[model samples]
Target: MTLNSGCRAEGKTILVTGASAGIGYFVAEQLAAEGADVALGCRDAAKADLAIQAIRVRVPAARLRSVRLDLADLSSLPATVDALDVERLDAVVLNAGILLSGPERRVNAQGHELMFATNHLGHFALVAHLAPMLAAAAHSRVITVGSFAARSELLDLDDLQSARDYRPKRTYGRSKLAQMLFGFELDRRLRARGADTASIIAHPGGALDSLTPSRPPLFVRTTAQRLRGLPAGVVLHGKHAGAQSIVRAILDTESTGGQLWGPRVFGLRGRPRRETPHAHMTDLEAADRLWAASVALTGVDPLVRPATPLRK
Candidate 1:
């Protein structure tokens, strides 16, 4: 279902990362169509232009701009924030991510494991840099896109950088789990600072169909799709149904500060609905550890006070 133009984001300014394609692209497009000024954050300037051009073609009046953002590079984050001229942001969507199968562990220039660096750490830095703008907005929201895979993983603070061992899929799951933990921790921290910003999490539930050669093997990815559904595609079990969940989370007033919204059907394919928090994700101690490591790794602290203490 398409989001109504009269929704909460109307007249607000939002920045969507990894908007060159997939759910990020759709989220930006939907937000723009609803009368929001959107900043499309992408790694490639040319691709970002193309994506913005596509959006303009469909919505000629769309108030959209493009910025270069590479989630793998922690240093590039501050520049991205500076490029956004607006003093405050109504919402920031940390949507850019990577899913790869590596035969051996790989590290980025920052000396971080490729999967964790790109998926979790990058976003961690971006949010910290944008924290001031978020706080300035006061009551603004931060919607992070996460996955169901986080349920199977636990945060290993001792090896957050993946120095000891690494399995591509498992590493990816760990990063996602970290993402959710950070989101929840952000909400708790905001409360401690008496800031009104809300941190919410949403998952697309695997309906994405677009592919690149570097992605997972055809049979494995395709099997996941078939098991999910046809019209929804393999990535999404139901056709664009995952989009509704995101839209609802972004606009739903009833949603609390740290809620997880998933699709309604099996594999989270249908309409949007509130889901129970993953058992592993409820560990506040892990969340606090992940937050501390994220701050040290990114060196961007937008919080006014120290992070909230985790429960035992």
Candidate 2:
């Protein structure tokens, strides 16, 4: 599929969460190269600075800044976004996420599951707080970064927190699935109201840190690491390649809302292309349930309109 780049991001200000490392870092780097003002949304100021420095090294005049954002804490979102101090945002890449390693289920300060909190709820609230800034732009986009792992999982609305059953991979997949659902649902809501913003979902397919190129202090792939990952190159790609889906979602003017974009090869490792979301990911009823649950958990409704009451 030939991707269109008609919507150049030059002169636009974009906010990218989790921009401190991995795929997020590369997304910020690529956007900077395109002449867009890239704001690195990170929980750690120091790390964001390193990412900015790294990008500047590559793109000498890279326009970048750090915005304090911690997706783990719901209460911090409003203040975090307010700190941006920008009247308009051309796009927002909700790419920050955490994958728990141990078998135990982790929870954030607010007691919600850690992965679910950061991966889904945090982004949900962040979008709510930034709705006005997004609407302020003549045309804006909210690109939610999901995972290919979501294809195998289903959200248990009752067990969203994984309180009932918690296996590391399952929980992580469900969290990502919830995020994708919100992305699709947000698109529906935006279109239903004829809003200026568009919501799109993009997944990094199968990105391996070892396969990724070095970005210095933020990411360093030793020669050994690169060699170790060479074999997996047949089906996996580096974070830089993984970031293409996000870049396309943000800049492809022809790409409409609710479309899923990922790698072209078996949705794993290749150039970015439009892909079909799993059946469960497109269930409207489940999407609505997840939406209500998110609002109840975060107390922030996205795209609030007086005429249309919040969905229950």
Candidate 3:
């Protein structure tokens, strides 16, 4: 509850999941400072409160709210949507995800691979649940945060879930690939339906906490990370820098549905600009397969199910 006094986003409302920390937090904070009413979607109440408090400190009159969204639990997502008081959402940034701590593959309660579950499937369900709000808005955008790994040669559709074969880097990259596939297909579907919303993609180049001026305690510095601190300054950009692409993807007036924006310089460190996604991510057949798999697994369809009328 605050006044958006002279910012471009004065009357807009946006939902940023995984906004409790890291790049998500940076994006949410920036949006709030710019006068957008931001719904910080997070599972941890403490972190959420901290994030809100931090933004208020900066913006002084920032409008902010919270919604509990745990990507690991599909059951909690729809309820999360129901709790949002906003009648329409101008943007929804699907930014929350996990880089698994170990090489051993883990699974969520629904049994999807941990990275894929949290990053792709969870976001898949969330976007579907929020579609109504998006439709209600005069214009809306759905921006997904992707990674450089999405361009790697690690994607293997034969074992998309990585049940039989799992490599940490490859699995993470594939999940990003899945996200892009969904994003592209989503734009195609939304356009076919003549929807006013746009589905856009953006990725932070090589952003890490180490490069941040504030250097918040987001992660413990490994010995190797410490050794490269000097090089990190040149190679790594801060979270704030990373957030530029997300902000542009969400608010850039010139952008269109299915367009992608990323770092200008080889994806390591630079300003945000429109860029093409990898060939693997642009595959329509793969997008269709991933979309079907996501629907079957999450039990939430982004298409027909969202428009179905509720019954008492």
Question: Can you write out model 3's per-residue Cα lDDT over 1-312, one digit (the tens) per residue?
Answer: 122233268789999999988899989988886778999999998888888887877788999999998988877776889888777999999999888758788988877788998899899988888888888887799998888878875456678889998888788888988888888889999999999989999898888766654422333456565556657767667778889888877776777889888877887777888897777777888888788878878877776555542211
Show where candidate 2 strays beyond 4 Å: 1-5, 305-312
Clashing pairs in model 2, backbone N/Cα/C closer than 3 A: none
Query: Model 3 scores what on Cα lDDT?
Result: 0.82
State in Å the error of residue 16, model 3. 0.5
lDDT of 2 by residue, 78-156 (tens): 7787789999999999999999899888888788999999999999988988888899997799999999889999888
RMSD of each candidate relative to the true structure: 5.8, 3.0, 4.1
Q: Candidate 3: TM-score? A: 0.90
Pitting candidate 1 against candidate 2, the one with the higher lDDT is 2
Which residue pairs of candidate 1 clash?
206-235, 206-236, 207-235, 207-236, 208-235, 208-236, 225-234, 232-238, 232-239
Candidate 2: Cα lDDT at 231:
100
For candidate 1, give the lDDT of residue 46: 84
Q: Residue 103 CA error for candidate 1 (Å)?
A: 0.9
For 1-312, candidate 1 gives per-residue lDDT tens digits of 554344646678899888877778777777777778999999998878877877776678999999889888776666777788778898888888887786688888788898899888888877777777887785688988888788888878999967887888888899888888888888888878778899898888866553211121111236554544455443345324555677677776776688988887654677788888876776788887788777777665547322432111
Question: lDDT per model, in order?
Answer: 0.76, 0.89, 0.82
Per-residue error for 62 in candidate 1, Å, reads 0.9
Q: After best superposition, candidate 1 residue 142: deviation in angstroms?
A: 0.6
